[model samples]
Target: MRLSNKLSHALSCAALTLAATPALADTVWLKNGDRLTGTIKVFDGGKLVVETSYGGTIPVDWKQVKTLESDRELMVKQDEFTGERAKSLKAAEDGKVTLINGEAPKTVELASIEQIIKPKPILEDLVWKGNVDVGLDYKRAETDTDDYDVDFKTTARHGAWRHNAEGGYNRESQDEVTTTNNWNAEYALDRFLDEHWFWQGRVSYTRDHIEDVSSQRTIGTGPGYQFWDDELGAFSLATLVNQNDYEYKDGGSDNFYSLGLKWDYNRYLVGKTFELFSNGELGKPIGGDSEYELDAEAGLRYKVTDWASLNMKAEKNIVSGAKDGEIDETRYSVGFGVGW
Candidate 1:
């Protein structure tokens, strides 16, 4: 009798624990009489994202939802109102939700909800993503030739400010003679004035080991406009007035003012398995020996997996009408890289 009672008590406790585990999760009912239990991530763009232990992150069509319940304080926006941080969510009638806000529960239609977002800390919600690519070539036996290149770009965003940094190095040697050798780095900071406008400050430096123009530096400030930034793509354009300085190996140097235009664009296609991107700057010297300067690159990235990609791009660099004559070059490269 004692043994049977002990076993019965153990089974009862186990059953209660199993039942309570599911009550901790939010619940959603579909029109097809199916029920889903998970933590609601967000509802945006006609999709409700949920984090589930069984299916990972899943996006459900908003139209198929009958009702939903949550115990989370989520930020929700309606068609004509700003975001409201509700205290919790409780199930209501079909196609309606009860927002528990400590006073009276406000009922809203699901169709009128424009967006739902989880609130995150301002300082703790920084986003960092970047890519690193490398290319190499080597040949031997007849004419000794070697070429190596490395390039990297990173961006970080916090609140209203965006930071960008990129740099690259390239070297080529044929017949024991170095034909091309240079490295450059640049950093730019942008502060958004609003959703579509911003102000920027930037500084850049470049050094060439085997060229007449050995050193170059620039400082600039500008205003910019952002077209759109979302899950699919981003694009921005800016104009700057810059102070440029150039130094030559022939004991010569020049400094002048220039107006420059810059653009950045990227798009994802084929269900985000491929991306197309281009960014560059063009400068017209106001008063200098250099007539026009151009630096640009356009590329395509094919995602092999979530974290790895194959990249191909073409780059052009020119400083025309310089003291050492026109300097023009174009390069094509294929590389392997990783991105986050």
Candidate 2:
């Protein structure tokens, strides 16, 4: 009888512990006398985005949060401080935070915290996210006309390494005459050397009918610097040594060396509903008679839903080495895109 009673007590205690686990989930306490219990996705743009069981996702202003507690590890960032991977952070009295990162217990004021990111689980740690946009049109007035455009982007991050790729194609035909035909693709890989320094390698291929070029290929690698990385914007600059190869329409080919500079920036506004981005690349020949080349784009995107957006973009491609009549090409387009 005694043995049976002991076994029954042990099983009862186990059941109660399992049932109480979820009740002790992460929590956020607001200064306005509100308490939210859910998973905090990230803190950015002065707001905290949380995923809840009953309310989906909610954005709460950071200033309104008085305390936070989580059982999972988080990537924490502060002004001028590198990101710290921490776990078991809990709120204490007097607007303080407590966590064990590596050393002994550490405490900090709530206001000094800039951002907190949930650690990605193994299944989603390296998931890719990006967008694709396509535009098409046809006309049958006096003459048949067809136009098509496609743009693609994708990126993934793992540990200190990041990878990005983008490409696009455009075509226009009027009465069986090809008015425009162009396509370009690029891929870049980056490894963060430190908080503000990184190394990158990139390769690109282009074919421009207007420039009288059958194909252009470039391969480059160099160091880069991150000037700023925050909720409002991120700006980066890089310089590289490029090997350029160009094939002309008249069965001519040229290979040369060039120095390339790249600039990329992004901005978000209106609670992440509106976004503006621009990236440009410039290549100046170092030897073998290759003129300067410039490729750039500026775009504004408005989110219509979680996965859908309306995008307006302007692009320019210039090759000073091109034939006299085909030196510059500019385009503007609007389209719908899906993002993951």
Winning model by lDDT? 1
Model 2: ten consecutive residues of lowest lDDT:
119-128
TM-score of each: 0.73, 0.75
Against the correct fold, how does model 1 do in TM-score?
0.73
Tens digits of per-residue lDDT for model 1, 1-78: 999999999999999989877458989999899988998976855778777778755678889988898888887778
lDDT of 1: 0.84
Going through the candidates in the order shown, the clash numbers are 0, 0
| Off by more than 4 A, model 1 | 1-122
- Judged by whole-model lDDT over C-alpha atoms, candidate 2 comes out at 0.80
* Candidate 1 global Cα RMSD: 5.3
Off by over 4 Å in 2: 1-39, 44-66, 70-89, 98-115, 123-128, 209-211, 230-233, 288-290, 323-326
The models' CA-based lDDT, in order, is 0.84, 0.80
